[model samples]
Target chain A: MHASDDGPHGHHHEHDHSELSDTALRVRALESVLVEKGYVEPDALDAIIETYETRIGPRNGARVVAKAWADPAFRDGLRRDATAAIASLGFGGRQGEHMVAVENTPEEHNLVVCTLCSCYPWPVLGLPPVWYKSAAYRSRAVIDPRGVLADFGVTLPEGTRLRVWDSTAEIRYLVLPMRPAGTEGWSEEALADLVTRDSMIGTGLARAPGGVAA
Target chain B: MKPLNAMTAALEPVAPLPRCAEEPVFREPWEASAFAMTVALHQRGLFTWSEWAECLGEAIRAAQAEGDPDLGDTYYRHWLLALETMVARKGVAGAALLAQRQAAWDRAAHATPHGQPILLENDPLFTRGA
Candidate 1:
């Protein structure tokens, strides 16, 4: 969760444009090479960006978070059988046949780390951040969840249970962040305001009043 | 080297095309919820490995009759959809809870000048009607 823990690779943005690695240089070079070869087209780049921003992202999660905040019975259903529960709300697809939601409580914390790869609930959370699927976070979280959380400014007290979910094969985990107080009469729009990408991934909790900065 | 994948490489021919399937459009929320629900159940040990397998197989068969089989990729896609579905079904946070968290993420993302931009990578088949 901590960017610093990403490695001592220096700030990614600090690298000089031309001093980039061979892979980076080659990628840039290929653009011109393709154009010279009559392979590059104008709309291709735009299409890539459009797909990621609109077709896949947190809008999916926004809907889920909204639903969770509105219907207590539905929330219970999700906690019980997420697949059936989700189907009840008229949502389903290829990777969504099996759904599960884990609760994060005051005495217990849930952090999801895919030890194998970035096997995230993308349909729900959208594409995982590049860092989450990186080996650095994967290797470190399971061995040192507290240390990792500390980097994210989330140091839990002693005796608190920290459950590290290693997405081994068939299972993946999503954190059901605790609902912050002071919003008893909030609407779904208001509730959706509190759901953060990080909270969904279990790195941080949603703040009620002095909410964390985006 | 072999010409780069049209999608990943620069020289290949990569353009979108429609599917031949005949079902309604596939919404990811349901899939995400299903993925989450499966993961949650497995995590809680509510069902055994065999039982879960059977449930998935049944779901797959039903989906297949509708149109696509969604083999191979469903293993992980189901998990993503399941999570979304679960969130929708459970109402885990209630209205205020959802809003509060959404703002928190937004704030955290914006707090840092170098935050990673959110991106969406839609499944090709999902773009097609069921």
Candidate 2:
């Protein structure tokens, strides 16, 4: 990833990475005022941020996906009721009270979006990337799924159909990508390494064998 | 990869706010702060939920009028706009002061790289409060 390219997990790079979204700066500005007025405690703020930032993130969902790939019974359970299956793994609360997992197969691809707002499954997938929240992505996601995927450098086969799910506050969707080939004997831990944040969002394909997911 | 620790500090706190079953997911640390600030301001009796809704609705309408396509992900932007306008209108803060802070943060954010936090103390222009 580039040091400052705009995408999901766009902030991740191998450098200083001090750049931030405009919303971040605006929030900082507001926080200065709130802190000055004593309306919020600095320590409390840090705890919530740390919870989502480090304690809970993509790894939570990655474990679920890896388990599905390794266990057929678990995959069936996930498809039957993703909420319980995910929560059974101990990753549920806040924005993930309701969860629906969409599987990607050879015949169809699934994409998730919040046409009215950014309704994401935060319990499983960490925070959304900047691009996913952009006006461009929001507008084009429902209207042009193929084009949006292309922008992310993803091209599906000609016969593959695209299914786009619009997220709401009550319900959220996650894309369960197809397990990559040549990973038959790999452990769940190794398989989880191939699952990226974008793959679960349907903007990217799972990493190929010996390929970098990020 | 860029170290996210520098860009966003962590935070925690939950408040009882009006919600029609709101899921309340934040895309970034700042988003959570923004949401908390809105609830905190309301708890302080600064404004009614109705008034906040009106301001947010008006802000969203204004953006749409300005050619924002109404795709919905930028709801927080409108929320920020509403918060800024309401705070200034309510006389809690001067409009000019808010404008100045906005500009200062914009400059600070530009100067900082992708992963660093933007603090008011880091900017010389933000010394008025000290």
Candidate 3:
């Protein structure tokens, strides 16, 4: 995906140094300095990484979407105030302090992008995917949402209006994808299984029933 | 899932959006380290997210000015740069100290043998209590 894959940092250089990339080495150095200087605790850093790496991610968002699909009151709450609705589910902190949920219906679809930088909802969706942070997607999504969706193999009907949400550091967005057909009476757990990360990002649709083992 | 359509392939020649991966938020260990360090520092009240975002935005903008391409690979590099700037600006650490540490790491990395973890003590100039 790199125009010039000179190295990991995209700068050409010869280094007899050990296996770490330049940026990696720099981060390690800074981390050691911070830890030594008592600016940050090593264990705290580990805990933060562990949280994002494992504890938090799209599954949290899936549960939110599944609940919205199953519970009308919760959906109403999400519509009125997404931040409180999401936090009510015990998902709020860091990058997701402010939350907004835009629903997808037969007439309209919602997509999220950060034109300035990768301002994603960490509490819900965890860190953004590489594609979501790319300048190509950032610029293109706003200019041509349908084309970008097509790149992800998502095609809406001819008259379906597409709305793109440009996320910022202040507010992060989560697309409440339309519930798939044949999901009637399904448990929230099963419904959540159909909510993929891409679906929440509005690049793809939630999986149809039977797409995953219930 | 369907394959990438022809339209995006034709339009984006220089930098096309990468296909999304299902799992693993970070592509590298250092990325996770840098990301976690920022959050950890914020949790410690080093700086607010607004301050952090401003620094990151400036870093990204500066990188763009210097032709970063913004293809997503060097994103955490910018993140690390912003973290460094924020730490330095917040008086947590100065640029000189950070530079000193970086040089020490360079020496340590070069001195250490292959397949060995690079440690600050590995620096050839290392002196205890100095």
Candidate 4:
């Protein structure tokens, strides 16, 4: 939040730096102090970062999507009860406790937003992207979802119904993007690799089969 | 279930965090870190949850007065402010240190190009000059 020219003290002079109150700097400072004071462990921070960056993010959701695509039973399970189906795969907690899985079909498109806050299914997805919480994304997604999708380089068929999910804390939403074509016989892992985080958020479509990985 | 928190009523936010909510959704890594620190401090008995709620409520109210729309987008930011409040009050760190660190980061961020991490030349603790 600290732009060079604007701050509480309004010290925006060039080539001068003695103090700053930007969020980044404040967080770093807080972290160092917490660590030095023995309130937090540096190694704990490392592990948390590693988990979010790799082990526990969109990949978890992708696996769920790919499994649903590969197994009719799993798909049915997810449709019947998203919370249970998602939990079966070990991605259940906190922001993800309540999930409603909306699928994209030939006749309909889906998008997710929390105009009130950045409510999302965190277990299946990792941390939300910076843009997701921006006022622009939060506001426009509810008003002009198709336009928002277009900004993400996604364009839908004219007649496809665009369904926007306004996620609340109790009931978060996740888009189950349609499995792309040309992947008939592809393993779940291969299909999972194609599920981009944006697709799950309903901002963009999943990568087409044999297409680029997000 | 824990009793519903009264702070939610005081804040009167359009989209309030669910009472007794275990965790709020995080949209960025820094957001999560900011969140983790607060929880850690509270868990260690640095402050009570009610106190946290009061501090956070006040921060949000202050931001609203400063022309924040009170949209949920600024929720974590309020959380950050509350954290600053607690850390300063509890003597975990001084406000000056935070300000100094923020300045250093601002300079580093300004010098660095987009999409690159901002690196502070000296750790804020060691930099007595600032």
Best by the TM-score measure? 3
- Tens-place lDDT digits, model 1, residues B12-63: 1321111122222223333333333344344455455444444444444444
Name the regions of candidate 3 deviating beyond 4 angstroms. Answer: A1-20, A212-214, B1-8, B12-15
Whose DockQ is higher: candidate 2's or candidate 3's? 3
Clashing residue pairs in candidate 3 are none
Score each candidate by Cα lDDT.
Answer: 0.52, 0.73, 0.85, 0.73
Can you give the DockQ of every candidate in the order shown? Answer: 0.02, 0.16, 0.50, 0.13
Indicate which candidate wins on DockQ.
Answer: 3
Question: What is the clash tally of candidate 1?
Answer: 73
Candidate 2, A90-117: lDDT as tens digits: 9987668779999999999999986554
Cα lDDT of model 3 by residue, A1-39, tens digit: 112336578685443345555777788778987887887
Record all residue pairs in model 4 with backbone atoms less than 3 Å apart, i.e. clashing.
A20-B103, A128-B27
Q: List the lowest-lDDT window of 10 residues for candidate 3 chain B.
A: B1-10
Best by lDDT: 3
Those runs of model 1 whose alpha carbons end farther than 4 Å from true positions after fitting are A1-51, A87-91, B1-130
